[model samples]
Target: MEVPSSEELLQFLSSCLSQIKWRLKSNSKRRLEIDVLALCTGMRPVVMIDYGGKMPELQNRLLSLLELIREGLPVFKDLKVMVIEDMIYLINVRSLPKFVSSSLDSEPELFFIDLEQDPPKMVTQSKESNLGMQLRSIQKLFSSTFPLDDSNTDTTTVLDEANSSQTSLCIDLSCCLQDTKVTIPTLNGWLLDYPVVYLFGTDHIEEAIYNLSTKSLRLFKVLVCRNGTTEKDSHLEELTSAI
Candidate 1:
């Protein structure tokens, strides 16, 4: 299979953005990378965010790409926004609440990157490892804020521990979040309320969807929205804005 050219990828990205009404930021940073890549395939810069690993080279490459893109399309450098924890929260802040309706913690987001589709992975195993390392370091740094019952456990540790191995990483949120209460036969029903709730393993887009679906199974109101999307990227922004 042939890898997608930078021009092709840019076009595809543009088309996607256009569908969502996102105007391409006209700035040096966005255009420079494309121009440079058009001139030399060897200079193609890739940006990858791997939650499972760490790679310093990936960071450096991203910086290079940003610099190049800035040189060509200056508006891009300022267009990107970063948010943490809550995808819905970001949408709310943007006043685009409609896209967030399905994106509440109950519905979360699901993103599938098919290798068979555009942009075949340029990120190597080494780069993935580096990204993983960086993630671990970050987790360690923020461990206190998001401490796990067992820090050494895998991301799906709660599912394995709770379901006695019957569950995969695809377990329900109630289980993963420790929201379900199992009392003796006297009160053998799941509790409706929880306090000081800490939801772990929800960092990935896939995990978020799973959690949302799980909560849905429990009949809770959940919203699922794609990350970083807003009025520019969705019609749902209309409904959100109306409210």
Candidate 2:
């Protein structure tokens, strides 16, 4: 049988994120966008949400925010890291976003290393991650959102309060290799870690840059699932606020 498609893998991964199957968008709720972005963008690991039109607006904002950092806009340095992850989740990012040239040891061991006689080609990004790399040759379409920052936070625009920041998601073996290997038994999870400056509330979204200067707050995260063509109005304000 052919392998599971990326969308299927995404669905499965989202299910795995929630530890359930039904009502992902609503169940995950407020945490939806933040949760998914943390996964897809974190230098460490994990997206399970879709915010409709608002999603695109947030994407444009995030992309604009990220580009500012690329162009040396010191005001937005803190947000630069998440920008990578947000880029993929915000838009139909197909080709890999060119790696920003990082030092080695920035990530854990590549999962692909265990296979093949000669060590697999050494690269910063691939079809899968360290663990995903080791499994069947599945796609790693999106790469880690970390690795692109300056060595320290003293030089950026976001998270000015904390000395250093990080975010992580607990992922299991299934995410690494979905359809390629079936009928597998109980699975264990590994912690995907990433650097991040956490914000406390949705209002913090407005103060993202300012909050970095405050030194006492947490980052935000969320997860979601697609439900037909219409926007669910129940959480429209919350979702719109997040976007």
> Which numbered prediction scores highest in TM-score against the true structure?
2
By summed lDDT, the worst window of 10 consecutive residues in model 2 runs over 182-191
* Tens digits of lDDT, candidate 2, 135-160: 21322212332323325223222222
Off by more than 4 A, model 1:
28-153, 156-243
| The candidate that achieves the highest lDDT relative to the unseen native structure | 2
- Give the per-residue lDDT digits (tens) of candidate 1, residues 1-243: 455554554655454444444343465334433433322332111111322112434333334443444354433332121122111000111121222232232233222221221232222212333333333333232232222343544445544454464212111222322332211110101011111111222234354345444442233332223234455763221101000
Candidate 1 versus the native: TM-score? 0.21
Q: Report lDDT (CA) for all predictions.
A: 0.28, 0.30
Give the CA lDDT, 0 to 100, for residue 149 in model 1.
Answer: 41
TM-score of every prediction relative to native: 0.21, 0.22
**TM-score, predicted candidate 2 vs. hidden true structure:** 0.22
Which residue ranges in model 2 land beyond 4 Å of their true spot?
1-29, 33-58, 61-77, 80-103, 113-243
